[model samples]
Target: MTAVPLSDDIALRIGLAARILPEIGVARLLRVLDSALGLPPTADTLERLRLRDLRQGADGALADLEPERLKDALAILRGEVGDTQPPPLPEPYVEGELPGSIRVACASDSGEQLDGHFGAARRFLVYQVSTAEIRLIEVREIDDGRAEDDRNSYRAGLIADCQLLYVASIGGPAAAKVVKVDVHPIRLGAGGEIREHLRALQDVLAGHAPPWLAKVMRQGVAPAGGAA
Candidate 1:
């Protein structure tokens, strides 16, 4: 897709924001701009804008553009955009542990795929407990080599079922140990939904999750009366 030119105001805002939030991507930046300007959905329009030529000068960088361009750009982008579907709930996998039980399952990718795990990529599923049927969620994909800091930031808020899953390709015992420690972290993974779940579970015992997310998590697990 070709890049669209940003208005002088939009370009300045983006440049300033990129400086402040270096981790923010162009799509997210566009979202911020839309909210600030009360612009309608422009995903498709923005996608059409090419980052092709960036002109920088003493007055900071300004994307040169023709007149009456923004409206056309917005219309084109909106037409190309579509509704995004929620990720599919994963199937449950059970692995027995000494005192507790570990269950694994995969969450369907929404639209984006992890860097490495393309065709062979499968989300990792982990659950502990037998009768209760609580599963810890983790996604594994081929390492795309992008910085993990921003991507892993959301680990904190993963629904109780979804936790960050890191898999070691080779070896047996060491990998098992890593997986165990990740599940029972002394500290929750950095930011995002997963951290929120960890904090919520800290005070309460297992089986506690935020109400909204709990609904989805329960659906992914087996029924209370159902066998493991």
Candidate 2:
């Protein structure tokens, strides 16, 4: 099959969208786009793409996908989902201000929820968390313009300061990149409110932390004074 030529911008969007849509890869998505948009897909075609177009073009390719996930994926292709205006970050935190805290990065698409895959998240919501407090310290938007080959590495570097990363899903290679940067990846298969995970971390901070977490805390400042 002759490969359809895609503009860089459209290609980047499709790449990210493919990651958002489970079980769909870039090549399959391109085939669907080719069928739906006819020949090479342009920015206009992508913007004009609708759910019906996707369904018709998919032709069983996406039959098993959840409706909402498909919609979100389509929205990404249509440029409706992104870090156009990122979520507000809390007051800046100096390192020692949250001495017992460890920095965490959450893969979020909508800001409130941890509902993004590592490779496709719109932004990384960075937080400083301890037993007593969880504060949003930074919001790092993904730079989609980076070359595709090193994009995963770039994303890993985005939150290198954090000791832990929370994502709804992450590929093994991407998770390996994250771990290489000393950030532990935590997958919440059923992604939920970011605060809920942080609060759970707080509970762990308040009690006997697991060995891995204890090591992380020691690397940073220290665990909560009373932590076992």
Candidate 3:
């Protein structure tokens, strides 16, 4: 049987679609695409296809695919690709003054977004967020063999110093455990860029912060307001 040819454009667009759709691996994405287009469920089209290596395989069968087709396929995708994650909590930033600093932990899979769950996060990107500064502290990766509760507790311990934690989501029990240690957990969406969120945090600091952020500022600086 002659196979349909793949195109570079199709591959690139499909790649973008795959990244947007959660819980879908490369193979599953192709199958979904095939099903959507009413093509037969033949694995031959992309059996050896690896999404990470898609650029090298676009020359084969996926060529000449229309942009409209890509859009249609994505529009009918099984689930919605949710909005980007929320930015860090707001705070005030006074230049060169010891206003205060709060350590924030962000859960991310690609370092591109705060898109990982509290319990499932492989690592947390730690940062020191001050009124006018944002600095990287470390990336703490998890490697515990304990059970679920223990692992959650352990992960919480790893970021004990961080006053605020941002994740894609957190189960109730895990949230309770984290709060027990005085670490505040904030939920962000699945697609927010960590760098962009950092800038947003800076903006929050530069403006009149909300109540929660006002507390952060209060904690980071003295009562005299903007330490000399």
Candidate 4:
């Protein structure tokens, strides 16, 4: 049977899908187009014809084709193109002082939660802190292998470490005095300004912590005390 001519809408949809879904293979692309355009089931002959048109268009070998056919042919041509893998993440910046706003690094082994918040992120850092120089921390790329339990453990460990650093800086007697103080309600701004607020908090704790405790507080951490 002679193949039916593609419609403008179908052609457009196919072209867009090919441009958008470069990872999709030609066979799969055809199937998706067929399903989306309500076209009849695809077969080997149709696939071969589509592939031929695609090759011709890609090599600038096609001319004088109908608009609808040209659209589909262009899509096929694009589908044949391949892309390289994404480049590796760049090194973390540590030229300036670490932000003090009680920064929390949240992650999971599954990568689901991180993906969900991808667009919402303003600034993220992978930090490495030592026991002796707890104040000096280095940021690195987010590790994907850290499981949920590991993340929870890291949170608790960070809180404990920060408290220790705070105590060491302030000395035992003074550290004990304000150990029970509650600082909370951390306010974050809409843009990158929130990181500055965190840095300000860090500056406040410089050389002020006791060896036994990190900075501890609850409530009133937010910028302008606004609700997140």
Give the winner by lDDT.
2
lDDT of 4 at 217: 32
Q: Write the per-residue lDDT of candidate 2 for residues 140-208, one digit (tens) a residue.
A: 777756525565687888888889999887767778889998889999978878999999999999999
Off by over 4 Å in 1: 1-44, 53-83, 96-228
The residue-by-residue lDDT of candidate 1 on 81-123, one tens digit each, is 1114333343444333213332322222233221111111123
- Model 2 alpha-carbon miss at residue 204, Å: 0.4
The candidates, ranked best first by TM-score, are 2, 3, 1, 4
How many pairs collide in each candidate, listed in order?
32, 0, 13, 40
The TM-score obtained by model 2 is: 0.67
Local error of candidate 3 at 101, Å?
A: 2.1
* Candidate 3 residue-wise lDDT, 59-142, digit = tens: 323223333223323422311222234333434533334346667788765544676666555567777676566766566665
lDDT winner, 1 or 3: 3
What's the C-alpha lDDT at position 195 in model 4?
A: 28
Whole-model lDDT per candidate:
0.32, 0.77, 0.55, 0.30
| lDDT value, candidate 4, whole model | 0.30
RMSD of 2: 8.2
Q: What TM-score against the true fold does each predicted structure earn? A: 0.24, 0.67, 0.51, 0.23
Q: Is candidate 2 or candidate 3 better by lDDT?
A: 2
Q: Over 4 Å off in model 3, which ranges?
A: 1-99, 146-149, 221-228
For model 1, what is the error of residue 157's alpha carbon versus the real structure, in angstroms, after optimal superposition? 14
lDDT value, residue 19 of candidate 2: 68
